[model samples]
Target: MQVEIGSNFWTYSLCEGRERKLWWESEEYSKIFLKSGRNAFKAICNYISADKRKVLFPAYHCGTESEPWYESDWEVEYYPIENNFTVDANKLKQCIIKAKPAVLVIQSYYGFDALNDECNALLQECRNKGIIIIEDITQSILSDIRHQAVDYYIASLRKFFAIPDGGVLISRQPIAIRKIAQGDNNIPLNAMQAYSLKREYFETKNKGIKEEFRAAYVVLNELISVNDNNYAMSDVSLKIWNSFDFTYIAQKRRENYRTLSEGLAKIDYLAITRTFDNDTTVPLFLPVLVKNNTLRQELQAFLAEKDIYCPIIWKKSPRIVDCPKETSAIYERILCFPIDQRYDKEDMLRIFNTVEKWNV
Candidate 1:
């Protein structure tokens, strides 16, 4: 059995007629049109006046890839939590009171759940304090809070869908976006490469050959450019969204997550992140926190040998703040296992069996 776990594949494949149209309409908001990924981030930065001098407080425990894009001076104040990693309201309040940030960025980790009460309170406090709140919906798009409580919200469309490059930014305030003057309709080599890479990824999966899948990824990564202009929000992305069925994709993701969680329950030292009460999310990945650093790496290698790719989702480290040394150390132990729509019961059983065998 082979399991593919590099990224979240788009769920548009599951929908029919009017239901598909509804998905696109649901994402649009009054005065705010969804802009492409990085462009949306740029627009928010401009609206919030977040330059290189102002400080932003991001939850330190969250993913690090997006923090630098803020292009502003920043400090990180992580929310305190117990063994289960729930957001700590009191600690969060204290941090907000002390840091007095201009903007607060929050993330729903692993899409495991939506914003907890503590998280909601923090957003309210930020609002009362007149600070901007940028919600990262990259992992938690299924949560209702994406439409509520944020001055601005951003999500990577490419992460959730099969499309090459796209991100949507929804805002409460209206602003004029200067449309780019179209001249050349030439598709950039990089965008074409990424498109090809995604095709190859799925192709290898269908073939049931794990080694070929890895090779496809290597080629895909090489051809893909992280900073290419062609992949910027284009007609192709919007067309893809219009044609796909997001609801079906969301349902499949939730179903797959449940199946994997149930199958892996008996494994010791492997605990999945629990969703918060009254919150729903299309869980992006199933993260299992192991007991020790050695076990984490060993499990990763064991899975890889079987062509089951498991990766470390987040490596906790200090942001540009004077955080306590102990907090920085937790970065080494978290591992994320695959739970997307691509894996079936047979594939899940293969993963679980690998873990059980490695228990000794």
Candidate 2:
């Protein structure tokens, strides 16, 4: 079998599922389900029309997360993050004071808890100053670290699950919203059709299906990039979300991550970016930092030849004016190893063995 370890989710077949309450279904928050994460962020920016329209973001990011801000014409500033992707509370406090941003957006990368006691205290101070806190839980969605004190939370559910299109916006207090409406375009429809083709390609290994499926992704990307309006999630995608067995999914991912960590412990050319608590973190992927950029790219190509795919999480964009040197280096050297629920310990071992062979 070809070991396709990363990339888009395949089509999911509906099955009997477990009954449980989602993390955001609490009575304390009013929620809206959107077609994608970008829409959720756009809605929040529209809702919170701050006097200055200034917002703060972390320097280490995928670069696309700030699009809604720019689309809405908000002034954006970034605060530096440590090498391990954690925020320094003192530095964060200093940035807030200097920037005087009306809004602060924070994220916990790869399902690990980024906020400690000191960070939480700093956020409380920001709230006291009437700064709105928006936690981007895209990576930390299913993890145990849910920050309720934040004024708002936004996440893309499709990132964590096999849904075609799903994003959510949650506010601490009840907020009046217009009735949910679909976008005038067909991005969701295109995505579902693309995923369905991907599933067929997986089953038949047909070259034509492969070409069509790949091309569909490119078209879908263009559609998503230009889609700025807020839209509701499709009925089919929401049904898939409702039918997921989240508990089992979390358990399998944790096991796979632990297995990979154990197997790669002796490798010298690379290291896992951050340590995560097994009890709390259901990591989205195992982030590995290579010693340099050239070696990282070579290793990525070597693994791809063996059918074990890994991804360089992101490239730094020129629009980010203030990223520190260390953070920029991370963008060049960091790679994400697949540890999702779809693969088991054996799959992780394949990744480790492949990397080990390439290292020599």
Candidate 3:
């Protein structure tokens, strides 16, 4: 197996000479009707007339998914969460009633829990108030949490799968739309390269080789960074992404996350995310809050030296907003460890051992 470190240390075997297959076969991949000028998020925005009058009430703690969508015409407001990252349901309700936002965004952090009844009730209330709810399922996938409740649901498929770039936006109400012609002619080479490398890595797994695969991954990430143009979905890449058995991947991820949580539970300084009430999530990564900022950075650096890639998933504040003091404080202490299907028990042990050694 090959090993490397960055946002998270990942290990994989190679799949150099294998039969080609679709990523998902039995189940239909979520259909995305793509228009030339608009992406999934833009489509959702158009549905809500967000460009005309956009207002987002994002929960304080989340990744960059909610920040980039804010436009000049749109006013973004952050609602505070308690020490545990759970929003105050009453406060959320009160804020929505008062602000009358155009859209309310909710992120299922770490995919460990679903929206609690209180949160759902608040979402329902917002719906009744004619406010749209956009669920960010970037981190949550398998719990079968119905998206029917929300006006629009979105997820960045890359975070969950091995594919390089894909964002899914599903809406219940069909708005006037247009599909981009297949030969629109502006495919980003860099993005396509990343997607290609990711495919290579996935295919090569289990070939009893790892070093070349790791090198390819590094190159792929570099390409992704340099490519500024948005990567539009290609027919081939979409087919590959949809071919993988999602059920197997999700089950493996869930089991791996549970193993990591149990193995590292004794680390007092690390505060892992607990399952939220009512919601069931497919855990993406095992996020921990270190005792202090120094420890967080030190551990990160130490892990990097060992080629153990741990990624800090999101920036603290992408823009100027009066974020809660608690959220800001926790952001400084948080780090995410790999707990996806790509890892196993030995991988978990290695991570735990590394952390324990550093604790000395």
Highest TM-score against the true fold, candidate: 2
Ranking by TM-score: 2, 3, 1
Better of 1 and 2 by lDDT: 2
lDDT of 2 by residue, 1-360 (tens): 334677777756566555876677779679888888887888888889678999998888766678778878999998877767788898888889889999999998888887788999889888888999999999988888877559999888877777767788998788655655774347667777888988887778775787787788888767655554677877777778888888888998899889998877768988776665557888998888888998888888898777677888778867797677767877878988888888888888888888877745
Q: Evaluated with lDDT, which candidate comes out highest?
A: 2
TM-score (C-alpha, index-matched) for candidate 1: 0.77
Q: Return whichever of 1 and 3 wins on lDDT.
A: 3
lDDT of 3 at 327: 71
**TM-scores vs. true structure, each candidate:** 0.77, 0.93, 0.78
Could you tally the backbone clashes for each prediction?
5, 0, 23
Predicted structure 3: lDDT: 0.59
Give candidate 2's error at residue 337 in angstroms: 0.7
- In candidate 1 the C-alpha lDDT for residue 165 amounts to 44
Our tally of clashes for model 2 stands at 0
Model 1 misplaced stretches (Cα beyond 4 Å): 1-39, 50-53, 60-70, 73-85, 177-231, 275-279, 317-330
lDDT of 3 by residue, 1-360 (tens): 235422322322233322433222114334453321125555555456643365555545443454346532466676665545566777777767677677787766677544568887777877876777887666665555554458776766666655543556665554454543342222234345444554455466443334554565566555433322334555443554546665666676676677777867888888876743442456777788788888888888898887677777555666745667767765777788887777667777788788877753
Minimal lDDT window, size 10, model 2: 176-185
